[model samples]
Target: MGYDLERFVGYVNEGLLCCVCRDVLEDPLQAPCEHAFCSSCIHGWLVHHNTCPEDRLPLDITHLRPLFRYMRNDLARLQVRCVFRPQGCEVICALESVHRHEQQCDYALLNCSNAGCPVQVSRRSLEAHLCVCEYSSRVCSSGCGYTVLNTEEAQHNCVSELRAELDMLRAELDCKVEEVRHEMESRLDSQRRHMVQKESLLRSEVDELKGQLSRVMSDVRILLGAERARRQELERAELEKAELLELLKKEGLRPATPSEAAPPPAEVQRKLSPRSLALDCIKRKNREVTVI
Candidate 1:
């Protein structure tokens, strides 16, 4: 049953009340049996029983039709007090507008957010109550370590609080400074070790490269020496060839022609001699003169 119905019993008409909820019909519905009920109330009743509440007859939610016209007209004409009437809300509104007013009612009860605070006050007074509530916890505006109630907050000593905070902050700062120093030292040590390793590696690579360069230089020297020796040998061979050619020329030892090998006819050979050749030339001239 609705709590409003009990409170508004004398003011609400029986015809406008739902049989199931015993409250004024919010959204009235009429069954096929011509029996009217709040839509929610009839549906809830139908959950366990398939029969109408007024008459024991089989009924289904589908058989219900809206009575909006009659319910709205009746609800608009009915006047109701605020749901927070007992909580000092004196406002009265039409039944149709009651939900809207109650939704915004300042007199509505509000529970305290603090878990340790069990008191509830009207929404309008909640802020005032929180200001004085011992269970209400709030941060210190003076930058203190402790959260205190509003009532006790004014009694806090800013001088002592700041001193304690300074001490705590100084300790934290020291720890942070030491931590940062340690981190920096660790990083520097790591970097130094890395640099040392890199330097060692570079030195090893340089030594290896130097050895390679030395080997290359040695190979170049060997190749140059071998080239020089080969050139000297070639030059010596050319000189010897020239000397042999000179000796051959002085000795008149040349390749023999076919004529030299077979020796010319004796007559031709004799004519080749200086005196015989001159006599032949004279005789040839005399012969030519006689022929002429």
Candidate 2:
């Protein structure tokens, strides 16, 4: 919306008046056709019609631009009264400075600072109103560290409020403690599972080693038995050799040479009588024992 023309201290240029609101242009924007209007007025106008409000020329929001620099300078130099003038503010300032003046103006209306307050008072009276406003808040004098509204001060129960706060804190602490306990239990369960798995793996390895050791022991035992048998055979052969040598010495028989020990011809053996064959077998046994 444009500023009210009556608020100005002196004459405002006709060109500075918004074509839509017919008031002094506020945040003026210019169309491509060189027509100026308040930013708000033009936007609202364009919402219903896409043409310029004044000349009805083909126009759009995209065709709007800030006011020309010369027009803006002239607009800023125009003197204007405070917006709170009806509330006793008599300050007159350049249009550019009017906003700054109104912000700090004592006549400016402000809502009551207390929550749920419905009263609106001038800045100069707000402090006095706060002193007596029933909706105003104040710290509890009961040492409960709570702020209570003035209207509810008489009914406020400091002890009950404090007890409720304490209960809430206790519940929160218990929840935290329960969470920590659960976390610890979960961790312990995970560790226990890991330990059981590791123990099983170790036991399996030990069992495997034991199986290998048993197999190796069986093989060693078999080898030892075979070695023992071989040694016993050699011992028996030696004993037999000793016995044969003693028999030969007692009978005054001499050991035969290798050539004399050779078997008789196959034809001769075939023709031998049973008695001769028996004597030949005895001599062969004696030679085998001598060789051992």
Candidate 3:
């Protein structure tokens, strides 16, 4: 169905030819009366009439039968040239395989898929044409909105690649600077918090030391007051002792009896031994003044 029937013009067997198309039969179908016609031709005829084209016999699509095995084997051997022969294809193929060969032929003409392209290329050249087609669009690598065909891409100079790169680097530098600034600020805040804590600790220690010093000073004052009272008591005792000794020396002495000359009682001896003896010597030295 894909090959041109004219390409098989003189090489077809008359027995295998379709009555309607006058060419080699392809997918031949036999009517109820055994008349053979190409399936496509008979199908098109049955669209208007329910009768076979050869015998005018009553027929429906359901009554149509496939051609015998001999007809198919004969059709398979029929030689046909590629439909793209005018397009530079020189290969000859069997009628049965002509469709397959034409489908893959390099000389096959293909219309460009691009809607704005009007070029017809060979099947092999189609791929290369699509690559450089003017109607095709592509994005600019610089992020500039200059999408156009490769043929006209050089007309618009929306942005320079070097300038775009410089802008990108500048933006990155600004971002890095901002990041560094934020990091520095964060470190400063952390250091300030640490300093505040250290100051608070130092103040607490200072208050503790002050409290300790105040307690020590109070203790020292109490000790000094006790020491002063003790010193005053000792001075008063010395003064009273001196006055008692003076009185003793001033009293008139009794004549020494035998018993008085004897040792005094133990209790009196203990009180008057060393200090009283010294006082007696002082009194004797003064007796002369009083006796005179």
Candidate 4:
């Protein structure tokens, strides 16, 4: 196959391709003089005379080359076998396409699900592999360890904002609860004071009513006593008056009073006696009453 100049220059700059027999030269070797060549080319040149191609220095198998060799494949893998046989990539592609298959293969992986994640994925199927991958999600900026889903990037940002708002609400609620508690305590204290004042007023009113009731009872007792004494005096006076009228009726044949003494008719004057005249004199002076 013809060599591509651009690819050849790139391989050279990378120090991965051999200078001679340059078709991705395999089995690189080094001379004791610190010069390098392909293993086959080195062996052929050494058969003629044991000397380095770049420097005419005597060579031996024991020395490592001073120039750094671009490592192509491991020593144990030199035997002919499919590159991806162990990884379930059964396609037997050459070494060039090995790196390509490893990139585009379904089992091949480049990195974690998080695009900027720095971890390397050693396994396959990124979806199934990263499902349980701890490094697959972006960290929460809210200082929480909670991981955000890949499909919910926008939603997670929204939730982060809502978490800030929730903190504010909690603070406000605490303030309101304290305010309400203080208001209730104030109301309870006012009610207690009012109750004490009202109790004092009621007790005073009860005392005044008791005093009024005692005065009214005392006045009634005094009036009853006075009424009883007045009734007795009036009864005595009535009896005395009745007795005076009876005396007057018995002495009807004589003059009832001195004021009644007058010149009588000649016949009536002749019938009057001296004893009757003395009794009339006592009755006329209004001194004849005897209560005994």
In angstroms, the error of model 2 at 196 is 3.9
TM-score, one value per model: 0.52, 0.58, 0.49, 0.34
For candidate 3, the 10 contiguous residues with the lowest summed lDDT are 255-264
Q: How far is candidate 3 from the true structure (C-alpha RMSD, Å)?
A: 19.1
Residues 80-163 of candidate 4 have per-residue lDDT tens digits of 223334556555444455556556665454577576567655456666767766445666767665666655555676566669
Better of 2 and 4 by TM-score: 2
Give the Å error, residue 269, model 4: 32
Candidate achieving the largest lDDT = 2
lDDT per residue, candidate 1, 1-292, as tens digits? 3436644524666777777777777667878887778777888999999999988889988999976576658766687778898999988777767889888899999898776788999999999988778888778776756787766777878788788889999999999999999999999999999999999999999999999999999999999999999999787666655644453353354444443334335754543435345544544454344334
Alpha-carbon deviation at 17 in model 4, angstroms: 84
RMSD of each: 12.9, 8.7, 19.1, 29.9
What local lDDT does model 1 show for residue 179?
A: 100
**Order the candidates by TM-score, highest first — what do you get?**
2, 1, 3, 4
Q: Local error of candidate 3 at 83, Å?
A: 0.7
| Residue pairs in candidate 3 whose N, alpha carbon or C atoms collide under 3 angstroms | none
Any idea how many clashes model 2 has?
0
- The C-alpha stretches of model 2 lying farther than 4 A from their native spots are 1-11, 17-24, 27-67, 85-92, 115-118, 156-161, 197-209, 216-292
Identify the runs in model 3 with alpha carbons over 4 angstroms from their true place: 1-5, 127-132, 157-292
The model with the greater lDDT, 2 or 3, is: 2
* lDDT tens digits by residue: candidate 3, 61-148: 9998988888878888778888888888888877878889989999999999987789999998899999988888777655676675
Model 1, residue pairs in steric clash:
none
Which is the better candidate, 1 or 2, if ranked by TM-score? 2
Each model's C-alpha lDDT?
A: 0.75, 0.87, 0.76, 0.57
In terms of TM-score, how similar is model 2 to the real structure?
0.58
